[model samples]
Target: MSFLRRLTQAFAPPPRAGLDRHLAMAVLLLEIAAADFSRSEEELGLIRKQLLTGLQLDASSAEALLSRALDRSDAAISMHEFVALLNEELDAAGKRELLSWLWQVALADGRLAPHEEGRIRQLADLLFIPHADFVQTRLAAGA
Candidate 1:
């Protein structure tokens, strides 16, 4: 009974108190991963690997989070909710680092589709990241 109660509690959702930054990151990454109009297995692999290594998530946890991210990204009409969540959760430096990661995703296939570039630029601006900084990050990421 105690074990069952603990399991139930563990599965309970977190309170919707404020914007969840992890959810935002997950959504943003999913968008970038799918920016080529079709999601590639290679891109999905990179996303999964990054979430596991960069975010230090276990396999099952990463899979679940990524799945949720994919859903949220699909449902979102604009990037406003994601930007708001990032602003609430991350400082400037953290936001920059996230931009770098997004660029890395853009470069995963050794090419950046125009649509992907456009999406990244829009997201960077929404995150309040300057164009220069965004370009520098992209160049640094070899995008």
Candidate 2:
């Protein structure tokens, strides 16, 4: 191996698939979080708690995952990147479950901003989830 390549590889952090999943979810959440044209600290806190309690993430791990999520949010071009990961990791049923969780985030601020609803619909379509199921999950998730 080349000297710099070997040196960099030696120091590089290990791969973090769990962190990637959480960050992907964060990208989707942040998209919804900003749907109201404002991203509040309250919204961020809710997102973190959802990731931690809802997704069963540990505290430090959740925080680390959130850091990467911030980076991923800045770099994302389309929602597809986030959904693609979920598509790969989750089956249709699991995707449906995630749809509910997504709605929870969208509605957490107490109102579903137009853009937030649109983003959720867009992601549901990309994930190949049916509209009926999407709506059902949304309602169940309190959206």
Candidate 3:
């Protein structure tokens, strides 16, 4: 019974809440991960790893955050909401770091899809990150 309950809880949707900066970033990452019209295991795994490492979340918290990110991603009409939250919350260095994470996700499959590049470009512009930073992150991510 205990194991079953834990398993059930693991699959359950986390409570909906206002989007925090971290969650906003996750939504954007998910968007980038799916930009190529397919969500490869590689992209998905990188996302989880980023959330765990970047956000310093425990496994369960990362899972819950990913759950919420998926719901937000599915229901989103545009990336504006997430972008706006990040714009308000992140500094220049923070934006650069976020872009690096996005680049990492975009390159997870060992290639950069055109759509993924487009999405990342749009996000960088929206985040007010300079072109140099964008290019630098892309290059650093192994292109």
- Those runs of model 3 whose alpha carbons end farther than 4 Å from true positions after fitting are 1-17
Residue lDDT tens for model 2, 21-72: 6677777878778777887787889888888987799999888877888777
Deviation (Å) of 113 in candidate 2: 1.0
Note the Cα lDDT for every prediction shown.
Answer: 0.83, 0.79, 0.92
Any runs in candidate 2 off by more than 4 Å, and if so which? 1-19
lDDT for 35 (candidate 2): 71
| Candidate 3: tens digits of C-alpha lDDT, residues 58-138 | 999999999999999989888887888899899999999999999999999999999999999999999999999999999
Q: Name the lDDT value of residue 74 in candidate 2.
A: 72
Error of 3 at 94 (Å): 0.6
Report the backbone clash tally of model 3: 0
Clashing pairs in 3: none
Per-candidate RMSD, Å: 8.8, 5.9, 10.9
Query: Which 10-residue window of candidate 3 scores lowest in summed lDDT?
Result: 12-21
Range of the 10 consecutive residues with the lowest summed lDDT in candidate 2 = 13-22
Maximum-lDDT candidate: 3
lDDT of 2 at 66: 76
